[model samples]
Target: MADQLGSARRLTTLDRLAGGSKKGVYRLRLDDQTTVILYVWAADENFWPASPTVPDDPFTDASGADLFAINHAALTAAGVRVPRLLMLDRGGRYLPSDIALVEDVGEVTLEALMARDPVAAAAPLSTLGDSLRRMHTTLGSHFGKLAAISRGEAAQARCAEDVVADRALGHLDAVATRDARLADAHDRVVAHVRHLRGAVSARQVYGLVHGELGPDHVFVTPANEPALIDIEGLTYFDVEWEHAWLRLRFGDAYPALRPVDLDPHRLEFYRYAQVLSLIEGPLRIAETDFPNRQWMLDLAEWNIAKALTPL
Candidate 1:
């Protein structure tokens, strides 16, 4: 790792940063008093196989380091604040998968900041909204996960309704096997989604969306601006999807700075879709060797119940 930095300075400290599921992040300090963030992608097939059940892949044909570098450059160019890239190893000549060294923006995350003071956090949350609006301003011709290697088009764009319906079906299958009530709610949600297909087809606008923009992925810079990190799940979708996530996470207080008029019904549909997507994780974990399998199943049921509730 020190050799990759091209600095002969001795390593002083290495502290592992939390909240990563596939990759490992760490705070690295050199004897020369330089600090940087080290991101290591998992190379093992168990963690990142070529053909996984999930459709999304951060390292699209490119290596993880290259993908991160490209996403950082693209987001930064789009007027969104992101951590500055320093060094990257795309070929994995030195590491297992790929690695990158980036400037340490700050120790505080938006989640932590919001927890500390909700009122004071409003500014950063608003800044986040602006940043997201800027990101979504770059429109896409199609809808789905944007190819990491290319900016011009999506690698696998499909009908928006098709995507939602597929996910809804998966949620239904998973829940139906366990809970009958949740299954019935999922059926209603699926039918509602099917009915919205025509409405989705009529829409023309689509843009880049940070598919997973939870508080942890957003950080505060020393300048107090909200900077985005973890670009793995970056994709292209309706800006309303992003708005739905924001509304779900932060409530109706933070309004999206959108150019087009958004449909409330479409937003509600996407909200339920998002809930269904969230339930998939717990369901998958429940099937695994994890100790809290039953707990995860219960959590999935709870999310289904929430999804069924009126918005």
Candidate 2:
């Protein structure tokens, strides 16, 4: 990989960027002072336990070359800002696993920006809101993965809310067996999810949702533009699904990321489901040797309390 690029730029430094549990994220600095990010989808870098959750369908932990390629195109076409793709190496002639080189968007994440200074973070957060509007308003004919949708085939005929409800139920069951507190509230949480799920009305349109979008998944460029990363799970789903996550992660800053006219019913259901996801996903990752084990466990425990709030 370096040999090819070395001819022109001369690769000088390679540092593994923090985060990215599913793929290896590395910053490659060339001798010329330019930088690029290399995404390596290999088993060694993946922290998810083998077969963590039973077939999560549309909401699965997404990764790999095919997904990245399709989603990048979909978001780009929708006028959503993603790190510009420099090259894709699917053949694996250089690296053992699928690798992609994209323009380095930089170190500043919206999460970091929000933590460092809220006053300065306002413009970028507002810009992120605009980006969300563009992404969500760019509707799709069907609700499913971008790869599936692009091939002119819908992933399912079921309502988008149904998918969330089902996945949430699965997470609830999985976590109950592991956590005592969740086990205590298992029946009640399940009932509330079902009740809310029943109240949710079916919809025809679906938006391009960044499945696990949070402030951390968003990067702010020097010009203060919001650039989306970890986009493999980009799909056509309920915009409220994305909004629920934004609400959870951004908190007080959520007003800056909120979209207009989100269904209250779907929001209620999806938000609860989001809590379940946080619990289940973190617990699953914690099963492996993820460096943030304590943090992950704390997240699961915190959401366990949040999960029972409605009841």
Candidate 3:
């Protein structure tokens, strides 16, 4: 595999960049003068974004990479600004099948920009809402039954169980007393969930959506085209799941959540789903990737507060 990664004719010059949990990414130049990004799969640990939620397959690392390829193809064909696929290798000796060679956008990721200026949040949040609306409108139905679209719900529930079992959830519970606002927020969220479930059926609200939506995945080019990447969390479930994830990351400052287009209930559902994703995902990632345990605990506490919320 090392030799394959280093080979210059087929794939050459892999300079490691950035990625989540288990995958290794690099900027490579193919012999065809095609500069592409390569993903090399190697997962020694599972768990991240930090909680004690074990993924469905604690050691299963290869599946999400392949799934991303499929999602990319679909999104690209639908006219979404997804990263173009240069090549795909699911897992093989000459070409490990799970990896992919994708076009590098060479632009600033929203995450980086947000880090530089978090106070000036409105512009990027609006841009994110517009991009999400485009995606949800264009390709949500093609992926699966509307209700099954958001995989985050299933993932989140499982993570909650795992956290309880592993005693990670206990960590957050311990801090609740000290953080009264966090506790109050948690209660409000729960009430919201109860109201939503009672008000509507899952079929009316579900569809395939980007299971994960955040500053990191939403990339913006100088031309203002917002390209969505990191398709690992794509799922077929409640369309609201997507909205919820976006709301959690970007908050209510989003421009499009007006009376006509946005549904707060759906956003609540998707947000809960995202909370589960973060819990299970980070708990399974390598420790080196998340050195600040306290920060992770803080995030987990926040998500947990969201997840257990009623609406």
**Top of the candidates by lDDT:** 2
Candidate 2 to truth, TM: 0.94
Question: What's the residue-level lDDT of 150 in candidate 2?
Answer: 68
Task: Give the top-scoring candidate (TM-score).
Answer: 2
lDDT of 1 at 269: 70
What's the candidate order when arranged by decreasing TM-score?
2, 1, 3
Please, what is the whole-model Cα lDDT of each candidate in the order they appear?
Answer: 0.68, 0.85, 0.52
Higher-scoring candidate on lDDT, 1 or 2 = 2
What are the clash counts of all predictions, listed in order?
Answer: 0, 0, 43
Off by over 4 Å in 1: 4-8, 44-63, 148-158, 178-180, 184-186, 196-201, 256-260, 286-299
Q: Candidates 1 and 3: which is better by lDDT?
A: 1
Candidate 2 Cα outliers beyond 4 Å, as residue runs? 1-8, 52-56
lDDT for 11 (candidate 2): 79
Model 1, 1-311: lDDT tens digits are: 55666757878899987665467888998888878998888744123223223353321333355456666777888889888888887786777677888889988888888888777678878778777778787886666444432654445554565566566566666656666776566567667666655455456567778776777788888788888888866766777777777776655445533334577767767777777766766777566555556777887878877867752
- CA error at residue 261 for candidate 1, angstroms: 3.3
Clashing pairs in 1: none
lDDT of model 2, residue 235: 83
- Residue pairs whose backbone atoms clash in candidate 2: none
